[model samples]
Target: MAGVAGRLARRWSWSAFRSPVQVTCSQAFPLHVSGTAMMATQADFENAMSQVKLLKKDPGNEVKLKLYALYKQATEGPCNVPKPGVFDFVNKAKWDAWSGLGNVSKETARQNYVDLVSSLRSSESTSQVKPGAESQQGTYETLVVTSDDGITKIVLNRPAKKNAITTKMYHEIILALQAASKDDSALTVLTGNGDYYCSGNDLTNFTDIPPGGVEQKAKDSAVLLRDFVNCFIDFPKPLIAVVNGPAVGISVTLLGLFDIVYATDKATFHTPFTHLGQSPEGCSSYTFPKIMGSAKAAEMLIFGKKITAGEACAQGLVTQVFPDSTFQKEVWTRLKAFSKLPPNALKISKEIIRKNEKEKLHATNAEECQVLQSRWLSDECMNAVMGFLSKKAKL
Candidate 1:
């Protein structure tokens, strides 16, 4: 929410948000465009932001997110929040863009951002940015999104850790999901890169959490979780999930919200909420019972039961399942077929189905955050998480 917080706090100044770029640097600076006029002053640094904002050309999402980060850096200086998860390519990129300016004075970031945009504007051969340089806009360090035709696939790439969801990764997924909703050219498919879909929240995220008292930390963490979960709940397009393997924690609970779920024979789902001595985060407390019935939901959430794909399907939690070896191929074909269906039809149908649940989901989200704040602060959870970490280190 650091990047988001900056975005939401906008004063939307006209000079920055709406201005004409025709005004040359000569007005605010001592010298030339390509020459010694390259020297710029503080006023010019501020003016450059306005000039860049007035560019006639569309710089695309990558450049846009970069500019946003740079503008924030120039105005706000170093990042004050935790780096977002690697899965959230947008915020991660923005964080990197802003974070890289660390040690750079706010005045300097403004000047450098001016220089960067000036160089970009002068390029005529192609509008496309240089490879790797565009990565400044964001990096998918733990996730990847690839598209063929109109079907886009977002993969959780941290297979070595069973695709564990880290703090940064959560932000990336939310950003990607938000992008998917607005992407008319692509319908999204989410799944894992290897053996497991996701193994739940990364323990290291706890370590990386902003330093604060237990209550403050819980508030921050709960707020982050609420935003992430809400992104999934309010997404404005058809969302499909391909469960290639086992999943745990919010990853398992999230399945209740997908429009359709296709799983592999090896796919299983688990939520270790009670086992971890914590409460649920994905609003599964409400969604799970509604989707799979109260009794089955209790068996899974309360007992932390491991649910096999076949069992999940029988309980109506899974839409379909395919052989493990051919899971990707089968799901790909099915999604492509789904892509062939009228996209607007799919969109409208999904909206209609989800419309009724929106308020309840948001209400549940608020309640869950309050409860989670308490759970996270409690001694039971503190001991449980530490015990797990201790054993993981074989200490």
Candidate 2:
């Protein structure tokens, strides 16, 4: 709480202090304009777009409309498309903006737009928009908290090691979630870096946990692990996951709790609990059987099967699977649109969906924690883990 307030206050306060370039592209009768080929080329259009992106502030909606009209006129020659309906103010404005340019040559429209950007650029000084105008304010050392346009993205940052979640990272992620829940943000996106979403708990930290009897189990950080997973169960805002790559261990299981799951075609989700002599941790013990049926959940937990992105989607674990190349951009654009909805409505809707299961989810988490802690010190668990680590070392 208090932490969330302080961090977000500093994070969002600077968004207003910016200098945005002004754009002018209004016409009452677009189709009536004179058609002439100006000297402006494709290079000019590219430069203007780049400059517009570099402005300290986001371009206004009107400017965006002009940019679209100019782009269409420049590339396609003219608006052959029919005007939108009178009720559709948005498309109507856009139609008049372009078709009204009626006979104007594509190059002429391009030249005027390019000249507009140049003039705006000349008026604003470099000092007005300094490099790194956005401070690394809410940014964490092991977690990336990127918040803009009412959505926050928490990217797991340990990409070099498949974005493995370390103890420190778990704590940082917990804090990030807490902050996002209390903040005005309408949605939060969770994903990992590099070629994997998250490899789950970093095994390096498990080296010291003695492998054997019930007496030695208490020393392991299983309780902390349980608490960390609980964070996902209680998240307030809409939580979405982008499974960018391989998701191992608890990472795959947590997908059951996300409001939406978007995965890349290259992604593989594996819950190798049986292979590791462990049990489900993230309430998958309850969620999986319900979401994917008892038979499928048994196959995943007992057999440790590797579920492909497509398989996960078919099993109802993933909301959608996108091509690896376009995964981020496609998911991000949709999330931004989702973020613009009525915030309270979204929250209440989510609450209603999870309403019945919320308490049982917590109870199951506690039950699963007890079983996992006991399993941690069992003889079978030790042999399995050591063998897995040994093979990993050989690789």
Candidate 3:
């Protein structure tokens, strides 16, 4: 039996690189001619048995085949040409390869591999489809939409560039919010499409704004963005955000206006206005400290350290953190639930909350616009912007 097994192993191994039929026929013929049954010692038998056990237990077909081939190639020359059909060795090999026997058959390992492959394939397909899917398809660089039940979702889509607020994008956002306000939609969910929600202003425009005498242009852009933020804050009906990634600058500050905010474990919240040599915008100076304590908000605005989603939840910046995998689904589900509530009740409730703060928000926005306009032309802000661009250019 041992001799037959050894010969079968060698034939299978050689066949892996050659032809299975030829090896099988050749090995069988030699054994018939020898007329003497070759045998193996107890130790040799044990070692060969161990090899079979390993082959049966290996999870991967490629790995098992390689090991089987190697074992055959190593032992075949020294072993005898054994009798045929002694142990059904080929059947065992096939069974092991297909079954993924022993330690490799655990449910957890299989599930892990399945999940890993799913994520890899999803990412690959997304990368291939993403470039052609946006802008060229009339999707626009800074706009996204999703729908669930009767709820409609709008997202700021420039996440790779940190959803930088452009003049056109700002105007479009105001239009979207206004449309949502008028529409009898069940809910409105707003968020960013990628890793960052928004990084504030589009610094690229600064490059074209000539070295001097572009103060009015800068002010115009800042006003447009601030107006959009104000419109979003004052929009009627429920507004929720699934902050699955970073929310920086105006993005973080604007969350104060949202009815609910859900962030992911990987989400980050930051506001770096003071560090950028400019005053805060989106009325963050007042709204941020009001939502989060003055001391905590001051620390973040001054230093600009990225706060984790969990920390944001604790600080009242976000409502909660959903697992990264199901964050969006969970957020939309909540939005749909909110949408099911009585529309008049929701509208009145939201108005009551904002009635007192509306005037305050407007005043703050106007003040912020003035500061931003003045700083936009200041040497400090210009130099900082230019420096940032220079570094970005190198990268």
* Candidate of highest TM-score: 1
lDDT of each: 0.69, 0.71, 0.60
Clashing pairs in 2: 29-100, 30-100, 30-101, 30-102, 31-99, 31-100, 31-102
- TM-score leaderboard ranking: 1, 2, 3
Displacement of the residue 35 alpha carbon in candidate 3, Å: 99
Query: Per-residue lDDT for 1-395 in model 3, tens only?
Result: 67765765565553243322111111000010000111123354334333333222212333334333323322332223343352667655543432322232122222222222222233344445555332232544568755556566778887677788776687667656655665667678777777776676787877766556597687667557555666765677788887867777777888888888888898888777766678777777777799888888888877776789998999898998999998778776777778788887887888787766764675566567777777887899888888888898999
C-alpha displacement of 244 in model 3, angstroms? 1.5
Query: How high a TM-score does candidate 3 get?
Result: 0.62
> Compared with the true structure, what per-residue lDDT tens digits does model 2 show for residues 1-395?
55644543343232331222222343210111111322457786678867765666533444445555666677676889887887655566667766755565676667656654553464254225443322233457787787789987888888999988777787677667756775678998898878889987776655744556345544336556655666787676799998899999888888888999999999998888988888897889989998899999988988888889999999998999999989889988888899999998998898778756654675576567767777877888878888888999999
Report residue 186 deviation for candidate 1 (angstroms). Answer: 4.4
**What TM-score number comes out for model 1?**
0.66
lDDT of 2: 0.71
Report how far residue 69 has shifted in candidate 2, in Å. 60
Q: Report the candidate with higher TM-score, 1 versus 2.
A: 1
Q: What is the TM-score of each candidate against the true structure?
A: 0.66, 0.64, 0.62
